[model samples]
Target chain A: MLNISNIVLEIFNILMKRIVLMGVIILMVVATVYLWLSNSGFSEGEGPYLGIIALILVFAVFLLIRRIKSWKVGEPQEDELSKKVMVRTAALSYYVSLYLWVFLLYMQDRVTFDKDRLIGIGILGMAIIFALSWVFHHFRGVPND
Target chain B: MTNRIKEFRVKLGLTQEELAKKVNVRRETIVFLEKNKYNPSLRLAFDLAQILNVSVEDLFSFEDEK
Candidate 1:
């Protein structure tokens, strides 16, 4: 199910979907780790998240052995500049996420969305914003001024 | 802020990749630094200056925005 092939176009579609699913899972792991680490201390609610991240990392490593080719095992990926970029991106995303929350709060009375779904949307929006902001800063660099 | 990192690096016959490797940063960081778009940390500036064999003052200068 995970194998990608050049010869068979039909099976390739299925494999591509699987690959994308794996990628999303990895991204979720990154988001979870970022949020967990950014917090001052671990809460009881975070215990399950830690377990989830561990399981995801193990699965990701298994995938890495067979599928991913770019990343090396045990090699450090982040550098000093990348760290700076992440810090800046995280700070920027926090401010933007507040507006999203305010909008959600504003919509609570008008919109029929369930409380759980609304909270889920807010979390997803934060992740997407963080990812996009990180990409922007990674390529463009944080503004000197 | 403006930096002469590219000038000094070229004089030392080092590519951006090589300099980044020496300084333990990504090559993109060097590209941004050379373009004067990123203000590097003091430690990074010191490390880069040392690698390029230039003083930090010679490598980077700040222009006050009036």
Candidate 2:
């Protein structure tokens, strides 16, 4: 006979998976729309709609992520392996973002474009590095420290 | 760190979920421990050893394989 605890655990796992998937889908959609808006806004001259779209998207994505993260907070503390992964990934993300900022600045000497756009790209690159590192560590084995 | 978690678990006739409960960890953690894919903390090792009716040294080993 199945125990009540077993049934509850099963339900919990299914709910967790669904919630995680929903978070992933939200991240993907936010990333796509953010990229598209950035590309089109700069290419076609800035306007009120572009500013409004960017602001709304940023706020919505920020709120959604915060909600999802808060939902995940608390519970079993991190394992030794998980702690190592987080520290390593965060350090890696920092270094990669630093180099990306330098690279973008270096490119500005050869090409003519909006310094504003370059600044935005630099900031976006850092966020991408952090997100990618988190995703990588989630799916991959421990990073080489 | 290779371990005899699966062997001991089988001997006790406990499912992964059941063992996880006794040890207070997720079932995936137990699965990984059994497969030698992840190392357990000292506390977890002790908990598993006790639940499986063995010593920590007997549960896992660091010596070279034969």
Candidate 3:
């Protein structure tokens, strides 16, 4: 019962899925590198790693912007439930980040905080948000049976 | 909330996908709404009413007994 158009659609869907997965992998690798660079001590004239990390962060931001810009919003687009789930997931992630930041502040004895650590936490928060949103979107209405 | 979306959609000879397109939502959203498993936002409800040519009250209902 598979028509040519159906086959093509399926292939496109698979390709899109693969691209998303790859994007996630790249993001994770960049995040790991960033964390490692931030935590490890560096010698004089060895600041290029930070520059490389900044470039990777910029690339990640660009990809996210591109994805959002290409997202369709109007008629024949994703339905109300999907939109609701998306909004809810984002809100949840924001609250989670807020609570975690508060906890970190409470645990620290010093009034001042490390800028690099703060930035690292921010990146991790965003990663968690995206991962959770994607998971919720994928599994929202599926039956357990 | 309960609705007669499926009946209206059928009467108008519109498929779920067609209605979703008209309402500016995803097809699965239409499915969920029809099944009464999901509630929509006020804006979305208004949009759906406009597309269905019905009032929000006509499209949706609230029951205290439920």
* TM-scores of the models, in the order given: 0.63, 0.57, 0.48
**For residues A27-86, could you state the per-residue lDDT of candidate 1 as single tens digits?**
887886887578857778557646645554664656544343312221224556677888
Find the candidate with the highest DockQ and give its number.
1
- Residue pairs in collision within model 1: none
Off by over 4 Å in 3: A1-86, A105-118, A133-145, B41-56
Report how far off residue A20 is in candidate 2 (Å).
13
Give the least accurate 10-residue stretch of model 2 chain A, judged by summed lDDT. A70-79
Which candidate achieves the best TM-score against the true structure? Answer: 1
Could you give the interface RMSD of candidate 1 in angstroms? Answer: 2.7
Native-to-model Cα distance after best TM-score fit, residue A30 in candidate 3, in Å: 6.9
Question: Which candidate, 1 or 3, would have the higher TM-score against the true structure?
Answer: 1
- iRMS, model 2 (angstroms): 4.9
Report residue A33 deviation for candidate 2 (angstroms): 7.8
The Cα error of candidate 3 at residue A121, in Å, is 4.2
Interface RMSD for model 3 amounts to 6.0
| Model 3 lDDT at residue B6 | 88
Predicted candidate 3 versus true structure: per-residue lDDT over B1-66, tens digit per residue:
688888878888999878877866767777878887677778978888888888999999887653
Q: List model 3 lDDT by residue over A11-79, tens digit each.
A: 567546644765787779887776766787565544654564555566556655544433433342244
True contacts kept of each: 0.53, 0.08, 0.50
